[model samples]
Target: MSDSDEKPEHQKENGEINGEEEIRLKPFQPWYSVQIKGASKNGEVVMFQITTVKLEQCKEEVEVDRQYEDFEWLQHCLNIVPNVKGVIFPPLPDRPIVSAAEAEAKSRKQLGTASKNIKGDEFHKDCRKLEKYLQGIVRHEAIGKCEALSNFLTKKEPPVRAKLKKGILSNLSRAVDGVRKGGHKDIDEMFQKERDLANDMQKIAKETSLNFDTMVNSLCRISMACNHLSTALCLGMSAEDNGASAIINKLQVEFAKSIDHYGYAVDVCTANDENTLGFHLDLYSRYWLSCKEMLFERTCALVQFDNASKTLEKAKPLKKPMAEAAKEDAEKELNAISEVAKKEITKFHQQRTLDFQKSLILYAEAKVKAARDVYALLAKDVSTIKQMDVEFD
Candidate 1:
């Protein structure tokens, strides 16, 4: 072949770099492997250190610090709110809780009393939740492949959150949204039932999470009481070198050690349950809320379609072209959303089953593991006492 007619060596099978017969790259929806390395808060705003890579390209890893607001912006860009696209956006993680101990420390610092840091491991859980949220958004086929997602993952600068609509516009939007959500009669019985079920499940799941948290707190108090008992026993022990008094002191010290171990075990095990079971329950509540919103979006489309059909009928006799065109657009939008929602609902149910099953199994395994941990801690302490040189001098 002539040199001018020949393709470049590098572009041979890789496709033409530049020519009339240029390479037509096949389209691909890239999956991102995302992780939240850490999270930190500045006042009310929390920023996450996120690292992500496009698994398909094996491109250079992109690490960026993103505020929670940035994530909200990403969702907004994907048409999550107003959800006119019939997409169920992944819910953001709940904000960190300021425990009573931490709050008291804050109060002390505010009043200028010397206070030490007493923050719990809430950051760890928050990081996990945020990571999962990112993963969910990226895993979705309907919305994940957007260029906005790429910018969110790779951009060093934060995305600008749009200002909330206020005054008349806000009121008008809310009124319209409310009518759309409530005005339409549900034609699909399955969807109606699913909506009610999802709402009920969300409520129960949230309450269950609170109950678990309360139980964990109560167990924590019990653990503290055990520690106090151990300390009291230790302090009450006699210092005499030999005789019955000495034997009694030894017994008190040994028992006190065992009590201390028990207290530690309770702290460890209950905390595990709190993180495993309680965390997932709270997560479910948020997910259900998003799922419900998706259904509402579909209903909104249905309401629009219903109104358009009425308008088209009125216009037909009058020969109004604009009204007929508007009606056609509405019908197209409604049909698109309906088809999308059918797939979405089925996927939602399937995912829900897998998630709940995994979470429940983990909770059960945690319970079993906690029980064993307590036994081991207490047993090890008691064994030390058993092997103690007990013969009187």
Candidate 2:
């Protein structure tokens, strides 16, 4: 009830102090207000309504009005909370970008596997197609040449010319159809038919010297066609083997032996007489030489295809397993850029080495043929000189 007990003006009721006790007023504590800025879908800046709440209670409690809106609400109490005082939002982890070389290598490996499988299936089909086309070309060319030669040799007899054309066309048609249908069960069967036809034509020529030119021309055409067919078969076999077929190596050996046999036969036929020799040599220089070149080119193409196929096949086994392993390892340790580069370079070198080996084989074959031709020509010239001397004696 004394002066010391009087209430301050701010705390007094009705401008008068209650006689019981003096009431003290507490000091005001500062509160911070936060405004969150965000973007809207139409590229306009949107201001969010200011929110007031304790910083400690702001977790998962702040609701954004729009799903796509960017916003954050931090109340005063939540900001001042001991644990939230130094809170920092971290940026997202960056995604790993694959290098172009790595991507290309992977694509090549996959494409190679696919190409290998596809090419295997296509090899025989393509061989058959090529055989048919070549047979047609050979028959047409032979018939035209034989007709001209028949006119020169047989005194232009219509009957003989007709017979020759009919026989050649019939044989060629049969061979082509057989090839198209994949009807030849074995190389032996195909060659047997070819040999029989050749022998029959040879006999016809022997019976009539007037028809000799036509016969020789026909023989040359037939031999060239056979050689082409043989090459195609060999290529198909090689492709099959590369495609993981068990028949590849076996076919390759068989075809090589067959080629050798044909080579010998051609040589024997060429050695028999001057006319036949000239015919054979001319055919060899034109068709066989070109064919050899083509074979080399085809070999290179097939090798490329095979290399791609093998790489792809090799990569297939590694894809899932390697990627999984890589992923697991990646989780433990991020993949270094250098590791990827090394893998790509290694694969490129392997492909290059394979291509080089294939090219070497093709080059060697060409060189061997060139050497054989040189020796054969020299021997032919020597034989001709000896024959002339003997004639004079």
Top candidate by TM-score: 1
Residue 10 miss distance in model 2 (angstroms)? 99
Q: What TM-score would every model get versus the actual structure?
A: 0.78, 0.17
Clashes of each: 0, 6
Per-residue accuracy of model 2 over 3-98 as CA lDDT, tens digit each: 666655456764455533334333222121222223222223222222222233442123222211111111122223332111211111111113
Please write out the lDDT profile of model 1 over residues 1-393, one tens digit for every residue: 777666576567455445434434433355788999998777766678999997877567889998766776787777843334766678877555545666666444432354343435467777888888888888887667777888899888877777644599888986788665754677788777877777788788778877877677667667767877999998897777688778778888889988987888788777777667777777778888888777787778777777887887777556678888888888888778777777777888798788878878888897798789878877887887888777775
In candidate 1, which residue ranges exceed 4 Å CA deviation?
1-30, 41-45, 80-84, 97-118, 161-180, 239-242, 313-316, 319-321, 380-393
